[model samples]
Target: MKKTFKVVVDCDDVLFDCNGYAVTKLNREKEYAYKKEDITAWGELGCGLDERLIYFRDPVFVRDMPVLPKAREFIQALSRRAEIFIATSVAAECAGERVSSIIRNFPEINPENILIGTRKDMLKADMLLDDCPDHIRSAEVTYPVLFRQPWNLSVSGVISTTTYREFLTLVDMVQKPEPEMDPMSPVVLVGPSGAGKNRVATALEETGRYRRVMGYTTNAGSRAFYRCVSWEQFHYKRNDFVETSSYMGEMYGTCREDVESVFREGRIPLLVMDINGAVNMRLEYGARIIFVSAGKEECIRDILSRGLPLEETIRRISSIDGEMKNETLCDMTVSGTGFRVSSLEKTP
Candidate 1:
């Protein structure tokens, strides 16, 4: 099946003759003819090498320059199937003129789509065309098409198009795929204490794929755990803070309010849980359960070394190694001994 997508075009070199304007600006001011290598010299002029890009800021730069060969026709054709956004970056001082030049080129282009910032990181366009190497590198995060310019020959690991038509051809060859995710289900991870349950969650958060839901508890908080409740709330009078299976004079329950808070933030919530809580959540929400474990001796040693009580540590070791129905609740078991938080992964 053919894939449909939104398109964003870059103004400078891909659609407009920016290099020609840059050459003209230098010649008019310096009384010298422009050369391709002269581009580097522009960066070296006034206010260090950075100030040279300021020449593109002049409104006349875009007004006087002609559209790149066939640039206008290609954009008009692509606009039929895609919502085209003209995403570009120009000097801040001349933003008004730069935007004016853009609108003058394509009378129908939306002013909202005309961007003027360096944080190409914030842009969410499907395709971008420019001559600069750094702009291409930044757009890779979202798989946007990057048109090659003379300045980008030194960049690596990037696919480049030399012309606007070639870019359209490139996007046509490779389809932009939509993501598949279970609408009602979130990616769930479960593991024993120190088995790296929270560690794996931390890793996922870094990738911007999932969100961490602080597991609620009735027990006194521990800093080692990813999220913990303060003693004040643990001692607060509430039925939700009751014990799971009375071992001594302690209570263990997942704080429903906290978990829900994470969901409210519009991200897939990740919760660390004891076997009882993990299983309960699985039954209630049918959440994906990941069981993390370690050998009896190794687990016990780790538990104690982290300052867990000896009696409590021994109790956990016995249950994990014993023949118990709870052991079957895990969807996946990952080795936790000497576990590096960064190495955790989910089995597909």
Candidate 2:
């Protein structure tokens, strides 16, 4: 028989009261995202949501935050039978503070048991009881017990419960197997403006299995763009036959040999470039291409929301749009809206 000895719990509405706490204290304008109507607004914090999330992550804040009735009791009871954890989402800005907060709240619980700022789907657990449908839906857990509440009403495949006693009963009965990870194949990714080529590339890199080709180019505003060099430096550094291609008074070249070097390596190469580049590569080597795209408004929204300097954001957007208009590219087209690396790789 397999070992059955671990459970992870969500901190927000499942353990503490989120909707009530937000209603009582959360500032509408500051805490919530911008919307034309107030009551109609969902729990999205628009412009500075990433920043405001930092406040709640502090040890002073979390310890003082009210714990739900029977939450501590249920956890204590479960702790006797299995290791229990308080897992919650931590925003990028205050990831440290969030971990500190959980450690302070439950001194008895080991620091390792508390995880924050994690993709719930990536978590390895025998069972997970959360109020958020996204958390349970995304995770491949053995027993996904949905704590019955207004927030979790729409979720499917959940054992609804009003009390911790009831939740514990369901947790005791379910049996689940460890999920298997399906490795991705070696293939090329393509996308238009607002399509998530860079994002997809990053996701693949994170797996540590895919060997992606980083293209060498002249557009180096950010590291995301190709590695750039001036005309004098390019010619001096690389003593090659001079081929001139000027854009906005700046000269650039595609180093054919450097791209070929990537193919020589046994890794999957990621070439993030225009349709011409893809076509040129296809002619040289028959590589597969996957296209990525997003709606105009969604693209603008995503770009602006990243907390980058406004000028830099606008410049990148303009450049991406320019490429989209110019390129006539590839095999499969995927939506850039709400693009997640795991979702894209899993898609057929």
Candidate 3:
């Protein structure tokens, strides 16, 4: 009978947002419209990889890539059903960063399970899930699971999965899968200021099932924003943050340790982030997103009532429409109609 006694997973396109980020950065920095799908073969990026290689060599650059969408959820579930191992190759310069990223993002995995070298032929596992066809073919595993990518689309005659969720299906089809774990997916409450997302986060935290992750910002508004540290602190421990994004010229981010702490407590980590940050975190961490909105007029009324500088107030109000446009990407939309204007002094 087939069984997933042990499974090896690849890092790049299979887990980390490597190629896509490289493509975006390459396009924006070099002004080239190279689509990721156009990379139909290995080394198709060819000379284009020169810059990406340089960046990948930097530990910060290596660690900053968001986890692939649904990757966290998939791994979390998969690890419970089988012995999971992370096997991939990275530049020697930033290999440690890759290992740290994997362990930090996926605590279910033991550090000993991370394999640095790309010698798939050396690994012993029941199945190998990798985006590279060569690696799949080389693996010593009983089943080589080709994680479909544009570069490997032409690769045939191997077991493959087109989506992250399908990998679990493949496991079930091969073996009688174990009951799945009820993973506590992190939740992000996102909206423009005055949308009462913070209020929702607070409510969730008060329920004891959720822990609100404190964010750090280097703006005068930190005093007005609840559970936010000074941006100076963020600067001091910048590497601790998984990602950082700007909101109205002020920087904000959540540190990895805070989220890990929530996980340790067996509680969901509730977070507040801007639209872009929320979207990235959702994809990177498989976090559920809740878009909180109270309508433009109500949002403006609440912002004005904050009595912040007129310029800052206008900036937040102007960005409301853009933020609202992203509601569709969120898993749930919550009505932030009650601003609780009384608490406006400390929360936005």
* Residues 268-293, model 1: lDDT tens digits: 65666554344345444545555566
lDDT of 3 by residue, 1-348 (tens): 854489899998899988888878878999888777767677635656446556666788788988988889999899877889998788888898999899899999989989898688898887789988788767777667777777775543355666666567555534642223234777788776788886786767776777887776766556544445665676787888765655445666678888889999988888887644554454457666667878788888899998888877777777676567556546657777653323311221
> Which candidate comes out best when scored by TM-score?
3
Predictions: Cα RMSD each: 21.9, 20.9, 15.7
- Provide the TM-score for each candidate, comma-separated: 0.44, 0.41, 0.49
lDDT of 2 at 98: 58
What stretches of model 3 exceed 4 Å from their correct place? Answer: 1-4, 44-50, 177-348
Worst 10-residue lDDT window, candidate 2 = 175-184
Looking at candidate 1, the ten consecutive residues that score lowest on lDDT are 241-250
Greater-TM-score candidate between 1 and 3? 3
Which one wins by TM-score: 2 or 3?
Answer: 3
How much is the lDDT of residue 148 in candidate 1? 50
Candidate 2 vs. true structure, TM-score = 0.41
Rank the candidate models, highest TM-score first: 3, 1, 2
295 in model 3: Cα distance from truth in Å? 68
